[model samples]
Target: MKIAIYTLGCKVNQYETQAMEQELSRRGHEIVSFSGAADAYVVNTCSVTAVSDQKSRQMLSRARREHPGAVVAVCGCYPQTRPEDVRKLDVDLIAGTGDRMGFLDLLEQELEDRRPMEAVDRVFDRRAFEILPAGGLEGRTRAMLKVEDGCVNFCSYCIIPYARGPVRSLPPEEAAARAKELAAAGYQEMVLTGIEISSWGGDLKTGQSLIDLMELLSDAAPGLRLRLGSLEPRTIDGDFCRRAAKLPNLCPQFHLSMQSGCDETLKRMNRKYDTARYFRSVALLKEYFDRPAVTTDMIVGFPGETEEEFAQSLDFIRRCGFARMHIFPYSIRPGTPAAELAQIPAAVKESRAARAAAVADEMRKEYLEGCVGQVYPVLFEQAKGDRFSGHAPNYTEVLVPGSENLHNRVLATRITGTEGFSLLGELEETP
Candidate 1:
């Protein structure tokens, strides 16, 4: 069987797609490009916003229309949250947020029987964490280990909590074992990713937290560079910063999720923390790490967001000095609380996003300028022409002129200058 997966949404989705690809390949299936025809086409969808849903729908429709004979399977958040919406489409199999292996089983069975099947279970009823393989089918530079699944933070703008259910965490021992396996497999770096990583230990009866899990993973894979996924502001404090600072292999970049900076806007969004607490998290990271790259995501022109509120958000983000930012205009997601509220006009949302993006660009330039004259151990991933590109511990892309294929090599690189968003660097000779 030939299978091609089209994935949407977050890093977790990407990891799951890769795991599915590996499993399918292991079971005597050929992985092909989504553009070309195949025996099975898996459209892993996302419903983060209404726009994401449209894309998912379009892809599914295209898959069915182009390859009339191929099996089209739809999975992920879009169908998980709205199975009724997906049932209206021309899909053969529908699986939700959980159970990838079972989903594949159904796919194989469908191929033989030619029956339409739906395997989306009650996501909230799930208790055990579905452990998938950590690394990708092809590369060794970086791999993602999903240590946790689900989110209980029912933010007004988010549909993930309902889509992914409550917190279900991978045990510390299991996570450590996976990290060790990735290290043994010659992976240069391991990314600990999830829907909400900060809520990792909530479901487990053990009195532990994300920092504790980080310590365990660091110990298990002492040679692998461990990177973290997006974290909640409440996860960072004095103790966490201090403990995390001591982990030599842990990357110094932190992506704290901050949707809006205005307190009123945060209240409307039902965020866990206010601006004061979020800023404290930023300050703590800056205090403990040496020029740590702090990145974040922000949504502009949220429902009922006044111009003053937007101004406050811009000012607050400027103060935080984020290394980079992902800015998006507010998009109404049906079934979420915010969708029923008075919506902002599309023009207003787009204009506010542009304003926020300008500020973010300035901050990014400032961060890149600060990187000049610093030395960092960069993990090279890819090469183009005479330059090899890699990322520093702070997650900053560093490009150096080199003839050698530095793929998967961590070399000492000294920043010489800034080239747009990336830093231009020269490789240091090892003695």
Candidate 2:
């Protein structure tokens, strides 16, 4: 059988799609591009926002229209939360956000029986972590290893808690094993991803945490660089930084989730931490790591966000001196508490987003300029034009003129200049 996968949303969704593809290939099926016709088309959907939901539906509609006879399967957050809405699209196989292996089996069964199959279960009822394969199809230098699942932080604007259920962790030994497997598979780096990786070990009685899992995996695969997915700001205290800094393989790029920088806006958003605690996390990372790339996400226009609050957020972000930031104008997601609250006009949201984006651009340029004249080890991934582009230990994209064979190999490069968000460099001679 030939299979095609169309993935939408975050790194976790991408990781799951890759795992499913690998599983199908292991079962004697050939994987093809989503644009190409196939025996089955898997649409791993996302419903993070109203916009994300619309995009998911658009992809599903296009997939069915393009490949009329192929078995269409939908899974992930969207179907997990609103299975009935997905069923209306007339997909052949529908499974929610659990038991991916079982979902594959059910997909095959539906194809065999030539009948529609709905395998979605109440997402809140899921308690066990579903272990999927790690790594990607291409021989890329980086891969993702999902060590945890689900989230307990029911932020007012998020539906992920309902769609993904409570925190369920992959045991430390299993996480270590998976990291080793990825290393053996020739992956040079692995990103530890999950819905809420900071909440890892909440369900465990052994008192293990994300730091424990990182320690285990760092030892399990010493050759592989370990990167983390979006992390809760509360997870980066002095203790966590001290232990993580000891791991030679851990990447220094930390993306702390800060939806809003203003304390008042954060309170309205129901975020767990205040601006002070979030700034402390940023300070601790810089204190422990050598010029680590501290990145963050910010929501520009929350409900009842006054001009004063917006200005406070802008100033707060500028004060943090973030290397990069993802700025979003608040989109009213239906079924979320924030959606029913006082709404901001589209023009106001757009203006705030634009203002935040300008500040983000300035910060990015400043960070890139700081990289100039520094020699860093870059893991080259691919060649483009007269240069081979890759990333440094801080996850900053570096482009340097090098041989095609440099792909998948780490090379020391002296930063020459900066072009927007990317760094231009040249290969440095060995000592």
Native-structure RMSD, model 1: 1.0
lDDT of 1 by residue, 1-431 (tens): 98999999899999999999999999999999999979999999898988999999999999999999999999899999989999999999998888999999999998999899998889889899998988886765999999899998899999999899989999999999999989999998999999999999989989999999999999999999999999999999999999999999999999999999999999999999999999999999999999999999999999999999999999999999999999999888899899999999999999999999999999999999999999999999998678999999999999999678888999999999998899999989651
lDDT agreement of model 1 with the native = 0.94
Top candidate on TM-score is: 1
Error of 1 at 353 (Å): 0.8
lDDT (Cα, tens digit) per residue for candidate 2, span 35-129: 98798888899999988889989988988898898898899989988887997996888888899999989988877887988888877888888
List lDDT for all candidates, in order.
Answer: 0.94, 0.90
Which candidate's lDDT is highest?
Answer: 1
Q: Which ten residues in a row have the lowest lDDT in candidate 2?
A: 400-409
Which residue segments of model 1 deviate by more than 4 Å? none
* Residue pairs in collision within model 1: none
In candidate 2, which residue pairs clash? Answer: none
The runs of at least 3 residues in candidate 2 whose Cα sits more than 4 Å from the true structure, single-residue gaps closed, are 429-431
